[model samples]
Target: MSTGPLNPETSTSLPSPPFVHLKGIPNFRDLGGYKVAGSDLIVRRGYAFRCGEPTSATPEAIETIRGLGINHIFDLRSLPEIQKMQVAGTGPKTVDWPGVTRVFTPVFREESYDPVSLAKRHADYQSEGSEGMVNAYRTILTEGANSYSIILRHILEDARRSKNTAETALIFHCTAGKDRTGVLGALLLSLCGVPDEVVAEEYNLTEAGLGEWTELLVQAVLKQGAASEEGARRMVGARKDSMINTLAMLRDEFGGPENYIVTKCGLTEAEVAEIRHFLVVGE
Candidate 1:
Protein backbone atom coordinates (compact mmCIF):
# COMPACT_ATOMS: atom_id res chain seq x y z
CA MET A 1 0.00 0.00 0.00
CA SER A 2 1.19 3.48 -0.80
CA THR A 3 1.84 5.45 2.39
CA GLY A 4 2.13 8.92 0.84
CA PRO A 5 -0.68 11.45 0.85
CA LEU A 6 -3.21 11.22 -2.02
CA ASN A 7 -2.65 14.92 -2.48
CA PRO A 8 0.39 16.15 -0.54
CA GLU A 9 -0.39 19.87 -0.90
CA THR A 10 -3.93 19.45 0.44
CA SER A 11 -4.28 20.68 4.02
CA THR A 12 -6.59 22.53 6.38
CA SER A 13 -5.66 25.85 4.81
CA LEU A 14 -6.54 24.67 1.31
CA PRO A 15 -9.63 23.00 -0.07
CA SER A 16 -9.29 19.30 -0.72
CA PRO A 17 -9.78 17.99 -4.23
CA PRO A 18 -12.94 16.31 -5.50
CA PHE A 19 -13.87 12.92 -4.08
CA VAL A 20 -12.17 9.90 -5.55
CA HIS A 21 -14.58 8.34 -7.99
CA LEU A 22 -14.87 4.58 -8.02
CA LYS A 23 -16.96 3.03 -10.76
CA GLY A 24 -19.99 1.04 -9.54
CA ILE A 25 -19.80 2.65 -6.11
CA PRO A 26 -22.40 5.29 -5.44
CA ASN A 27 -21.99 8.15 -2.97
CA PHE A 28 -18.34 7.42 -2.25
CA ARG A 29 -16.42 10.35 -0.76
CA ASP A 30 -13.94 11.30 1.90
CA LEU A 31 -15.38 12.55 5.17
CA GLY A 32 -12.62 15.16 5.32
CA GLY A 33 -12.35 18.73 3.89
CA TYR A 34 -14.69 20.53 6.25
CA LYS A 35 -13.25 23.13 8.64
CA VAL A 36 -14.29 22.55 12.19
CA ALA A 37 -16.20 25.51 13.58
CA GLY A 38 -14.58 27.73 16.24
CA SER A 39 -11.18 26.13 15.71
CA ASP A 40 -8.22 26.28 13.39
CA LEU A 41 -8.66 22.60 12.73
CA ILE A 42 -9.90 20.56 9.79
CA VAL A 43 -10.94 16.96 9.30
CA ARG A 44 -7.82 15.16 8.12
CA ARG A 45 -8.38 13.86 4.61
CA GLY A 46 -8.01 10.20 3.53
CA TYR A 47 -8.47 8.98 7.11
CA ALA A 48 -12.24 8.57 6.85
CA PHE A 49 -14.71 7.85 4.04
CA ARG A 50 -18.45 7.23 3.53
CA CYS A 51 -20.09 5.30 0.71
CA GLY A 52 -22.88 3.04 -0.48
CA GLU A 53 -22.58 -0.74 -0.72
CA PRO A 54 -19.61 -1.86 -2.75
CA THR A 55 -20.93 -5.22 -3.87
CA SER A 56 -20.86 -4.20 -7.52
CA ALA A 57 -17.52 -2.47 -7.31
CA THR A 58 -15.44 -3.12 -10.40
CA PRO A 59 -12.05 -4.68 -10.02
CA GLU A 60 -10.45 -1.29 -10.65
CA ALA A 61 -12.74 0.36 -8.12
CA ILE A 62 -11.90 -2.32 -5.62
CA GLU A 63 -8.24 -1.57 -6.22
CA THR A 64 -8.99 2.12 -5.72
CA ILE A 65 -10.72 1.45 -2.39
CA ARG A 66 -7.83 -0.76 -1.39
CA GLY A 67 -5.51 2.06 -2.38
CA LEU A 68 -7.30 4.34 0.05
CA GLY A 69 -5.38 2.35 2.65
CA ILE A 70 -8.42 1.74 4.81
CA ASN A 71 -7.81 -0.68 7.66
CA HIS A 72 -11.28 -0.74 9.22
CA ILE A 73 -14.69 -0.90 7.57
CA PHE A 74 -17.90 -0.36 9.53
CA ASP A 75 -20.85 -1.68 7.54
CA LEU A 76 -24.19 -0.30 8.72
CA ARG A 77 -26.34 -2.18 6.25
CA SER A 78 -29.15 -4.44 7.37
CA LEU A 79 -28.68 -8.19 7.21
CA PRO A 80 -30.79 -8.49 4.08
CA GLU A 81 -28.83 -5.73 2.44
CA ILE A 82 -25.56 -7.41 3.34
CA GLN A 83 -26.86 -10.69 2.05
CA LYS A 84 -28.02 -9.07 -1.15
CA MET A 85 -24.56 -7.63 -1.63
CA GLN A 86 -22.96 -10.98 -0.94
CA VAL A 87 -25.27 -12.86 -3.26
CA ALA A 88 -24.94 -10.26 -5.96
CA GLY A 89 -21.16 -10.29 -5.65
CA THR A 90 -20.99 -6.52 -5.09
CA GLY A 91 -19.41 -4.23 -2.47
CA PRO A 92 -16.27 -4.93 -0.49
CA LYS A 93 -15.53 -8.51 0.29
CA THR A 94 -13.07 -9.32 3.07
CA VAL A 95 -11.45 -11.99 0.92
CA ASP A 96 -10.60 -9.39 -1.68
CA TRP A 97 -8.56 -7.46 0.87
CA PRO A 98 -7.10 -9.77 3.47
CA GLY A 99 -5.36 -6.98 5.37
CA VAL A 100 -8.54 -5.00 6.05
CA THR A 101 -10.77 -5.62 9.06
CA ARG A 102 -14.47 -5.53 8.24
CA VAL A 103 -17.16 -5.40 10.89
CA PHE A 104 -20.82 -6.08 10.16
CA THR A 105 -22.82 -3.64 12.24
CA PRO A 106 -26.28 -3.98 10.80
CA VAL A 107 -28.35 -0.98 11.89
CA PHE A 108 -31.61 -2.85 11.47
CA ARG A 109 -31.73 -6.50 12.39
CA GLU A 110 -33.11 -9.27 10.17
CA GLU A 111 -36.22 -9.76 12.25
CA SER A 112 -36.98 -6.08 12.46
CA TYR A 113 -36.60 -5.07 8.80
CA ASP A 114 -36.16 -8.07 6.62
CA PRO A 115 -36.28 -7.80 2.82
CA VAL A 116 -40.06 -8.16 2.58
CA SER A 117 -40.60 -5.70 5.41
CA LEU A 118 -38.07 -3.29 3.97
CA ALA A 119 -39.89 -3.39 0.67
CA LYS A 120 -43.09 -2.48 2.46
CA ARG A 121 -41.24 0.29 4.26
CA HIS A 122 -40.05 1.66 0.95
CA ALA A 123 -43.65 1.62 -0.24
CA ASP A 124 -44.62 3.52 2.89
CA TYR A 125 -41.89 6.00 2.03
CA GLN A 126 -43.69 6.62 -1.27
CA SER A 127 -46.84 7.78 0.44
CA GLU A 128 -45.11 9.49 3.34
CA GLY A 129 -42.58 11.34 1.18
CA SER A 130 -39.82 13.24 2.95
CA GLU A 131 -41.79 13.07 6.17
CA GLY A 132 -41.43 9.30 5.98
CA MET A 133 -37.72 9.63 5.46
CA VAL A 134 -37.53 12.02 8.43
CA ASN A 135 -39.32 9.50 10.59
CA ALA A 136 -36.90 6.82 9.43
CA TYR A 137 -34.02 9.05 10.50
CA ARG A 138 -35.60 9.45 13.91
CA THR A 139 -36.02 5.70 14.17
CA ILE A 140 -32.34 5.22 13.44
CA LEU A 141 -31.37 7.68 16.13
CA THR A 142 -33.69 6.26 18.73
CA GLU A 143 -33.94 2.56 17.95
CA GLY A 144 -30.51 2.07 16.44
CA ALA A 145 -28.65 4.05 19.05
CA ASN A 146 -26.86 1.00 20.37
CA SER A 147 -25.50 0.07 16.98
CA TYR A 148 -24.43 3.66 16.40
CA SER A 149 -22.81 3.82 19.80
CA ILE A 150 -20.76 0.77 18.98
CA ILE A 151 -19.78 2.25 15.62
CA LEU A 152 -18.77 5.58 17.16
CA ARG A 153 -16.80 3.86 19.91
CA HIS A 154 -15.02 1.70 17.41
CA ILE A 155 -14.13 4.71 15.29
CA LEU A 156 -12.90 6.58 18.35
CA GLU A 157 -10.80 3.66 19.46
CA ASP A 158 -9.35 3.17 16.00
CA ALA A 159 -8.54 6.83 15.63
CA ARG A 160 -7.01 6.90 19.06
CA ARG A 161 -4.77 3.92 18.45
CA SER A 162 -3.79 4.59 14.85
CA LYS A 163 -0.83 6.85 14.08
CA ASN A 164 -3.06 9.11 11.90
CA THR A 165 -1.76 7.39 8.79
CA ALA A 166 -3.55 6.24 5.65
CA GLU A 167 -3.17 2.61 6.69
CA THR A 168 -5.15 3.34 9.84
CA ALA A 169 -8.02 5.00 7.99
CA LEU A 170 -11.61 3.94 8.65
CA ILE A 171 -14.64 3.83 6.35
CA PHE A 172 -18.31 3.36 7.18
CA HIS A 173 -21.35 2.84 4.99
CA CYS A 174 -24.96 1.72 4.68
CA THR A 175 -27.01 0.59 1.68
CA ALA A 176 -27.94 3.94 0.16
CA GLY A 177 -25.05 5.63 1.94
CA LYS A 178 -27.45 8.50 2.52
CA ASP A 179 -29.89 7.91 5.31
CA ARG A 180 -28.08 5.76 7.88
CA THR A 181 -24.64 6.79 6.72
CA GLY A 182 -25.76 10.41 6.56
CA VAL A 183 -26.95 10.53 10.14
CA LEU A 184 -23.75 8.93 11.44
CA GLY A 185 -21.65 11.22 9.26
CA ALA A 186 -23.56 14.23 10.54
CA LEU A 187 -23.08 13.20 14.14
CA LEU A 188 -19.36 12.66 13.68
CA LEU A 189 -18.94 16.04 11.98
CA SER A 190 -21.01 17.72 14.66
CA LEU A 191 -18.85 16.11 17.32
CA CYS A 192 -15.79 17.47 15.52
CA GLY A 193 -17.33 20.96 15.92
CA VAL A 194 -18.82 21.43 12.47
CA PRO A 195 -21.92 23.63 12.41
CA ASP A 196 -25.29 22.10 11.68
CA GLU A 197 -25.52 23.94 8.35
CA VAL A 198 -22.25 22.43 7.15
CA VAL A 199 -23.31 19.05 8.40
CA ALA A 200 -26.58 19.30 6.53
CA GLU A 201 -24.74 20.49 3.46
CA GLU A 202 -22.53 17.46 3.58
CA TYR A 203 -25.57 15.27 3.88
CA ASN A 204 -27.22 17.01 0.96
CA LEU A 205 -24.25 16.26 -1.26
CA THR A 206 -25.58 12.74 -1.58
CA GLU A 207 -28.40 13.95 -3.84
CA ALA A 208 -25.91 15.01 -6.43
CA GLY A 209 -23.38 12.27 -5.85
CA LEU A 210 -25.97 9.57 -6.21
CA GLY A 211 -28.23 11.28 -8.67
CA GLU A 212 -28.29 8.57 -11.32
CA TRP A 213 -28.75 5.75 -8.85
CA THR A 214 -31.31 7.73 -6.92
CA GLU A 215 -33.32 8.08 -10.07
CA LEU A 216 -33.13 4.37 -10.68
CA LEU A 217 -34.19 3.62 -7.13
CA VAL A 218 -37.12 5.97 -7.41
CA GLN A 219 -38.09 4.35 -10.66
CA ALA A 220 -37.87 0.95 -9.10
CA VAL A 221 -40.13 1.97 -6.26
CA LEU A 222 -42.58 3.50 -8.70
CA LYS A 223 -42.54 0.38 -10.81
CA GLN A 224 -43.43 -1.67 -7.79
CA GLY A 225 -46.45 0.57 -7.16
CA ALA A 226 -44.93 1.48 -3.84
CA ALA A 227 -45.24 5.23 -4.24
CA SER A 228 -46.37 8.04 -6.46
CA GLU A 229 -43.82 9.57 -8.78
CA GLU A 230 -43.47 12.59 -6.50
CA GLY A 231 -43.34 10.33 -3.48
CA ALA A 232 -40.69 8.16 -5.03
CA ARG A 233 -38.59 11.20 -5.87
CA ARG A 234 -38.89 12.49 -2.36
CA MET A 235 -38.04 9.09 -0.95
CA VAL A 236 -34.90 8.55 -3.02
CA GLY A 237 -33.45 12.06 -3.19
CA ALA A 238 -31.44 13.52 -0.31
CA ARG A 239 -33.06 16.76 0.73
CA LYS A 240 -31.43 19.44 2.87
CA ASP A 241 -34.65 20.04 4.79
CA SER A 242 -34.74 16.43 5.92
CA MET A 243 -31.33 16.65 7.54
CA ILE A 244 -31.99 20.16 8.81
CA ASN A 245 -35.17 18.97 10.49
CA THR A 246 -33.43 15.89 11.85
CA LEU A 247 -30.67 17.99 13.40
CA ALA A 248 -33.27 20.24 14.92
CA MET A 249 -35.00 17.17 16.28
CA LEU A 250 -31.68 16.03 17.68
CA ARG A 251 -31.29 19.36 19.44
CA ASP A 252 -34.85 19.49 20.68
CA GLU A 253 -34.89 15.92 21.94
CA PHE A 254 -31.30 15.27 23.03
CA GLY A 255 -29.94 18.84 23.26
CA GLY A 256 -27.34 18.28 20.47
CA PRO A 257 -24.88 15.80 19.08
CA GLU A 258 -22.77 15.64 22.21
CA ASN A 259 -25.76 15.02 24.40
CA TYR A 260 -27.15 12.48 21.96
CA ILE A 261 -23.82 10.70 21.86
CA VAL A 262 -23.43 10.60 25.62
CA THR A 263 -27.03 10.14 26.70
CA LYS A 264 -28.73 8.26 23.91
CA CYS A 265 -25.70 6.50 22.44
CA GLY A 266 -24.08 5.71 25.81
CA LEU A 267 -20.68 7.14 24.96
CA THR A 268 -18.72 8.75 27.77
CA GLU A 269 -17.58 12.33 27.80
CA ALA A 270 -13.97 11.20 27.74
CA GLU A 271 -14.55 9.09 24.64
CA VAL A 272 -16.25 12.02 22.95
CA ALA A 273 -13.30 14.25 23.78
CA GLU A 274 -10.95 11.61 22.48
CA ILE A 275 -12.85 11.58 19.20
CA ARG A 276 -12.37 15.31 18.73
CA HIS A 277 -8.78 15.10 19.86
CA PHE A 278 -7.85 12.35 17.42
CA LEU A 279 -9.93 13.31 14.37
CA VAL A 280 -9.52 17.07 14.44
CA VAL A 281 -6.07 18.40 13.62
CA GLY A 282 -4.51 21.84 13.61
CA GLU A 283 -2.39 23.36 10.84
Candidate 2:
Protein backbone atom coordinates (compact mmCIF):
# COMPACT_ATOMS: atom_id res chain seq x y z
CA MET A 1 0.00 0.00 0.00
CA SER A 2 3.08 2.24 0.24
CA THR A 3 5.18 3.59 -2.63
CA GLY A 4 8.84 4.23 -1.96
CA PRO A 5 12.13 2.92 -3.32
CA LEU A 6 14.36 1.33 -0.72
CA ASN A 7 16.48 4.23 0.57
CA PRO A 8 19.48 4.83 -1.68
CA GLU A 9 21.77 5.58 1.24
CA THR A 10 21.14 2.31 3.07
CA SER A 11 21.37 0.34 -0.17
CA THR A 12 24.64 -1.52 -0.59
CA SER A 13 26.44 -2.18 -3.87
CA LEU A 14 29.53 -4.32 -4.44
CA PRO A 15 29.19 -5.05 -8.13
CA SER A 16 27.63 -8.03 -6.42
CA PRO A 17 26.70 -6.85 -2.97
CA PRO A 18 23.27 -8.34 -3.49
CA PHE A 19 24.52 -11.04 -5.89
CA VAL A 20 27.82 -12.56 -6.80
CA HIS A 21 27.51 -13.51 -10.46
CA LEU A 22 28.97 -16.97 -10.32
CA LYS A 23 30.03 -18.06 -13.78
CA GLY A 24 28.06 -21.27 -13.63
CA ILE A 25 25.14 -20.04 -11.55
CA PRO A 26 22.46 -18.11 -13.36
CA ASN A 27 20.83 -15.22 -11.51
CA PHE A 28 22.08 -15.80 -8.00
CA ARG A 29 21.40 -12.86 -5.68
CA ASP A 30 21.11 -11.79 -2.08
CA LEU A 31 17.63 -11.14 -0.73
CA GLY A 32 18.26 -8.68 2.03
CA GLY A 33 17.68 -5.24 3.52
CA TYR A 34 14.52 -4.44 1.57
CA LYS A 35 12.05 -2.24 3.44
CA VAL A 36 8.92 -4.11 4.47
CA ALA A 37 5.72 -2.38 3.37
CA GLY A 38 3.55 -0.21 5.65
CA SER A 39 6.16 -0.33 8.39
CA ASP A 40 9.70 0.63 9.27
CA LEU A 41 10.65 -3.03 9.33
CA ILE A 42 13.09 -4.24 6.67
CA VAL A 43 14.18 -7.64 5.52
CA ARG A 44 17.65 -7.82 6.99
CA ARG A 45 20.53 -7.89 4.54
CA GLY A 46 22.70 -11.02 4.37
CA TYR A 47 20.23 -13.04 6.41
CA ALA A 48 18.98 -14.85 3.28
CA PHE A 49 20.14 -15.50 -0.27
CA ARG A 50 18.68 -17.26 -3.32
CA CYS A 51 20.56 -18.77 -6.23
CA GLY A 52 21.44 -21.76 -8.39
CA GLU A 53 24.27 -24.16 -7.68
CA PRO A 54 27.90 -23.09 -7.12
CA THR A 55 29.60 -26.19 -8.49
CA SER A 56 31.32 -24.62 -11.46
CA ALA A 57 32.24 -21.36 -9.78
CA THR A 58 35.87 -20.42 -9.68
CA PRO A 59 37.77 -20.56 -6.41
CA GLU A 60 37.40 -16.79 -6.11
CA ALA A 61 33.64 -17.02 -6.59
CA ILE A 62 33.52 -19.75 -3.98
CA GLU A 63 35.42 -17.54 -1.54
CA THR A 64 33.13 -14.65 -2.39
CA ILE A 65 30.14 -16.83 -1.49
CA ARG A 66 31.73 -17.91 1.77
CA GLY A 67 32.51 -14.31 2.60
CA LEU A 68 28.81 -13.58 2.41
CA GLY A 69 28.59 -15.25 5.83
CA ILE A 70 25.97 -17.76 4.75
CA ASN A 71 25.46 -20.35 7.48
CA HIS A 72 22.63 -22.45 6.08
CA ILE A 73 21.72 -23.77 2.63
CA PHE A 74 18.44 -25.30 1.45
CA ASP A 75 18.84 -27.11 -1.85
CA LEU A 76 15.53 -27.60 -3.64
CA ARG A 77 16.89 -29.42 -6.65
CA SER A 78 15.54 -32.85 -7.48
CA LEU A 79 18.06 -35.67 -7.03
CA PRO A 80 18.52 -36.16 -10.78
CA GLU A 81 18.84 -32.45 -11.35
CA ILE A 82 21.70 -32.36 -8.89
CA GLN A 83 23.27 -35.44 -10.43
CA LYS A 84 23.06 -34.03 -13.94
CA MET A 85 24.65 -30.78 -12.83
CA GLN A 86 27.30 -33.17 -11.46
CA VAL A 87 27.98 -30.58 -8.84
CA ALA A 88 25.89 -32.11 -6.14
CA GLY A 89 27.60 -31.80 -2.77
CA THR A 90 30.89 -31.12 -4.53
CA GLY A 91 33.02 -27.94 -4.61
CA PRO A 92 30.97 -25.58 -2.50
CA LYS A 93 29.62 -28.38 -0.35
CA THR A 94 30.29 -26.71 2.98
CA VAL A 95 32.29 -23.65 3.82
CA ASP A 96 34.42 -23.38 6.94
CA TRP A 97 31.73 -21.37 8.68
CA PRO A 98 31.05 -23.21 11.92
CA GLY A 99 27.59 -24.62 12.59
CA VAL A 100 26.71 -24.36 8.96
CA THR A 101 23.91 -26.77 8.02
CA ARG A 102 22.96 -28.15 4.62
CA VAL A 103 19.41 -29.29 4.12
CA PHE A 104 17.90 -30.93 1.06
CA THR A 105 14.27 -30.48 0.03
CA PRO A 106 13.67 -31.82 -3.44
CA VAL A 107 10.92 -29.91 -5.22
CA PHE A 108 10.03 -33.13 -7.01
CA ARG A 109 10.75 -36.65 -6.04
CA GLU A 110 13.23 -38.64 -8.14
CA GLU A 111 10.40 -40.96 -8.99
CA SER A 112 8.64 -38.15 -10.80
CA TYR A 113 11.11 -38.53 -13.65
CA ASP A 114 12.29 -41.23 -16.00
CA PRO A 115 15.87 -40.08 -15.52
CA VAL A 116 16.98 -40.44 -19.14
CA SER A 117 14.13 -38.45 -20.66
CA LEU A 118 12.45 -36.03 -18.25
CA ALA A 119 15.12 -33.31 -18.23
CA LYS A 120 14.94 -32.86 -21.97
CA ARG A 121 11.17 -33.09 -21.85
CA HIS A 122 11.07 -30.37 -19.19
CA ALA A 123 13.28 -28.17 -21.33
CA ASP A 124 11.07 -28.67 -24.37
CA TYR A 125 7.91 -27.99 -22.40
CA GLN A 126 9.36 -24.86 -20.85
CA SER A 127 10.38 -23.54 -24.26
CA GLU A 128 6.77 -23.59 -25.52
CA GLY A 129 4.87 -20.40 -24.53
CA SER A 130 2.81 -18.24 -22.15
CA GLU A 131 0.66 -21.28 -21.42
CA GLY A 132 3.56 -23.41 -20.20
CA MET A 133 4.86 -20.57 -18.10
CA VAL A 134 1.40 -19.80 -16.77
CA ASN A 135 0.76 -23.43 -15.94
CA ALA A 136 4.15 -23.54 -14.22
CA TYR A 137 3.19 -20.59 -12.07
CA ARG A 138 -0.21 -22.11 -11.31
CA THR A 139 1.39 -25.41 -10.37
CA ILE A 140 3.78 -23.44 -8.22
CA LEU A 141 1.08 -21.54 -6.37
CA THR A 142 -0.95 -24.69 -5.78
CA GLU A 143 1.59 -27.47 -5.19
CA GLY A 144 4.59 -25.22 -4.70
CA ALA A 145 3.04 -23.78 -1.56
CA ASN A 146 3.66 -27.14 0.07
CA SER A 147 7.41 -26.58 -0.03
CA TYR A 148 7.07 -23.35 1.91
CA SER A 149 5.99 -24.97 5.19
CA ILE A 150 9.23 -26.92 5.26
CA ILE A 151 11.28 -23.88 4.24
CA LEU A 152 9.45 -21.66 6.71
CA ARG A 153 9.91 -24.21 9.43
CA HIS A 154 13.61 -24.44 8.67
CA ILE A 155 13.93 -20.68 8.81
CA LEU A 156 12.04 -20.47 12.09
CA GLU A 157 13.88 -23.36 13.69
CA ASP A 158 17.23 -22.11 12.42
CA ALA A 159 16.59 -18.65 13.77
CA ARG A 160 15.59 -20.11 17.09
CA ARG A 161 18.72 -22.24 17.21
CA SER A 162 20.87 -19.30 16.20
CA LYS A 163 19.33 -16.77 18.57
CA ASN A 164 21.62 -14.00 19.78
CA THR A 165 24.28 -15.12 17.35
CA ALA A 166 26.29 -12.79 15.16
CA GLU A 167 24.28 -13.53 12.03
CA THR A 168 22.82 -16.41 10.08
CA ALA A 169 21.97 -16.66 6.41
CA LEU A 170 19.92 -19.23 4.49
CA ILE A 171 20.04 -19.72 0.74
CA PHE A 172 17.32 -21.59 -1.17
CA HIS A 173 17.69 -22.86 -4.69
CA CYS A 174 16.30 -25.09 -7.39
CA THR A 175 18.08 -25.76 -10.74
CA ALA A 176 17.72 -22.25 -12.21
CA GLY A 177 16.68 -20.33 -9.11
CA LYS A 178 14.07 -18.77 -11.35
CA ASP A 179 10.68 -20.45 -11.31
CA ARG A 180 10.40 -22.26 -8.00
CA THR A 181 12.52 -19.92 -5.90
CA GLY A 182 10.99 -16.92 -7.62
CA VAL A 183 7.48 -18.04 -6.71
CA LEU A 184 8.48 -18.52 -3.08
CA GLY A 185 9.99 -15.04 -2.92
CA ALA A 186 6.97 -13.50 -4.61
CA LEU A 187 4.49 -15.27 -2.35
CA LEU A 188 6.30 -14.35 0.86
CA LEU A 189 6.47 -10.70 -0.14
CA SER A 190 2.88 -10.76 -1.39
CA LEU A 191 1.69 -12.13 1.95
CA CYS A 192 3.26 -9.02 3.45
CA GLY A 193 1.25 -6.93 0.94
CA VAL A 194 4.24 -5.82 -1.06
CA PRO A 195 3.11 -3.87 -4.12
CA ASP A 196 2.86 -5.82 -7.34
CA GLU A 197 5.46 -3.68 -9.13
CA VAL A 198 8.02 -4.15 -6.36
CA VAL A 199 7.48 -7.92 -6.41
CA ALA A 200 7.73 -7.97 -10.22
CA GLU A 201 10.89 -5.89 -10.12
CA GLU A 202 12.53 -8.44 -7.85
CA TYR A 203 11.27 -11.37 -9.94
CA ASN A 204 12.46 -9.86 -13.21
CA LEU A 205 15.95 -9.24 -11.84
CA THR A 206 16.76 -12.83 -12.73
CA GLU A 207 16.50 -11.94 -16.39
CA ALA A 208 18.59 -8.79 -16.00
CA GLY A 209 21.21 -10.78 -14.14
CA LEU A 210 21.23 -13.88 -16.34
CA GLY A 211 24.70 -15.38 -16.81
CA GLU A 212 26.18 -16.96 -19.96
CA TRP A 213 24.36 -20.28 -19.59
CA THR A 214 21.02 -18.54 -19.61
CA GLU A 215 22.13 -16.62 -22.67
CA LEU A 216 23.08 -19.92 -24.28
CA LEU A 217 19.60 -21.28 -23.76
CA VAL A 218 18.23 -18.31 -25.64
CA GLN A 219 20.86 -18.66 -28.36
CA ALA A 220 20.24 -22.37 -28.76
CA VAL A 221 16.53 -21.86 -29.22
CA LEU A 222 17.13 -19.03 -31.65
CA LYS A 223 19.60 -21.09 -33.67
CA GLN A 224 17.00 -23.74 -34.10
CA GLY A 225 14.72 -21.06 -35.57
CA ALA A 226 12.31 -21.58 -32.73
CA ALA A 227 12.26 -17.90 -31.86
CA SER A 228 14.33 -14.77 -31.86
CA GLU A 229 16.64 -14.05 -28.98
CA GLU A 230 14.13 -11.47 -27.92
CA GLY A 231 11.28 -13.93 -28.12
CA ALA A 232 13.23 -16.66 -26.40
CA ARG A 233 14.18 -14.21 -23.71
CA ARG A 234 10.53 -13.46 -23.18
CA MET A 235 9.74 -17.15 -22.97
CA VAL A 236 12.35 -17.82 -20.29
CA GLY A 237 11.77 -14.64 -18.33
CA ALA A 238 9.07 -13.76 -15.80
CA ARG A 239 6.72 -11.02 -16.91
CA LYS A 240 4.34 -8.85 -14.91
CA ASP A 241 1.30 -9.93 -16.91
CA SER A 242 2.06 -13.60 -16.31
CA MET A 243 2.32 -12.92 -12.60
CA ILE A 244 -1.07 -11.21 -12.66
CA ASN A 245 -2.57 -14.18 -14.46
CA THR A 246 -1.00 -16.53 -11.95
CA LEU A 247 -2.46 -14.44 -9.14
CA ALA A 248 -5.83 -14.69 -10.78
CA MET A 249 -5.40 -18.43 -10.93
CA LEU A 250 -4.51 -18.46 -7.26
CA ARG A 251 -7.52 -16.31 -6.43
CA ASP A 252 -9.90 -18.54 -8.36
CA GLU A 253 -8.42 -21.84 -7.25
CA PHE A 254 -6.92 -21.22 -3.83
CA GLY A 255 -8.16 -17.74 -2.94
CA GLY A 256 -4.55 -16.40 -2.74
CA PRO A 257 -1.09 -17.46 -1.65
CA GLU A 258 -1.62 -17.00 2.09
CA ASN A 259 -4.94 -18.80 2.09
CA TYR A 260 -3.47 -21.51 -0.13
CA ILE A 261 -0.74 -22.05 2.42
CA VAL A 262 -3.12 -22.23 5.34
CA THR A 263 -5.94 -24.24 3.85
CA LYS A 264 -4.05 -26.41 1.39
CA CYS A 265 -0.47 -26.56 2.58
CA GLY A 266 -1.38 -27.04 6.24
CA LEU A 267 0.75 -24.25 7.65
CA THR A 268 -1.06 -22.88 10.70
CA GLU A 269 -1.25 -19.21 11.58
CA ALA A 270 1.01 -19.86 14.56
CA GLU A 271 3.69 -21.24 12.27
CA VAL A 272 3.20 -18.28 9.96
CA ALA A 273 3.64 -16.00 12.96
CA GLU A 274 6.88 -17.70 13.92
CA ILE A 275 8.11 -17.35 10.32
CA ARG A 276 7.33 -13.66 10.43
CA HIS A 277 9.06 -13.28 13.77
CA PHE A 278 12.20 -14.96 12.51
CA LEU A 279 12.54 -13.63 8.95
CA VAL A 280 10.81 -10.28 8.65
CA VAL A 281 13.04 -8.10 10.81
CA GLY A 282 11.70 -5.42 13.18
CA GLU A 283 8.14 -6.73 12.97
TM-score of each: 0.83, 0.75
Number of clashing pairs, model 2? Answer: 0
The reply for model 2, stretches above 4 Å from the true place, is 1-17, 21-24, 86-100, 111-131, 162-166, 220-231
The true-versus-predicted C-alpha distance at residue 140 of model 1, in Å, is 0.6
lDDT, candidate 1, 1-283, per-residue tens? 1111111111122223435676666677888878999878987777789876655566677677778787678887776555544222343243245557778777787632321234466545544435666677788888778888888887777766774543467778776678788888988888788887888888887776663565556655555455467766766667777788888888888788889999988988898887777778865
Cα displacement (angstroms), candidate 2, residue 219, comes to 3.7
Per residue, candidate 2 scores C-alpha lDDT tens digits across 1-283 of 1111111111123245566655445567877656678788866567778875544455555555667776677766666655544222232242233455667766664622211222233443345345556676675565555566678777667667866342656778765567778877777666655666777777777655554445554544444444345655665566766666666676688777668778876877776665665556763
Q: What is every candidate's alpha-carbon RMSD to the true fold?
A: 6.9, 8.0
Best by lDDT: 1
Q: Tell me model 2's lDDT, rounded to 2 decimals.
A: 0.58
- Candidate 2 deviation (Cα RMSD): 8.0
Worst 10 residues of 2 by lDDT: 1-10
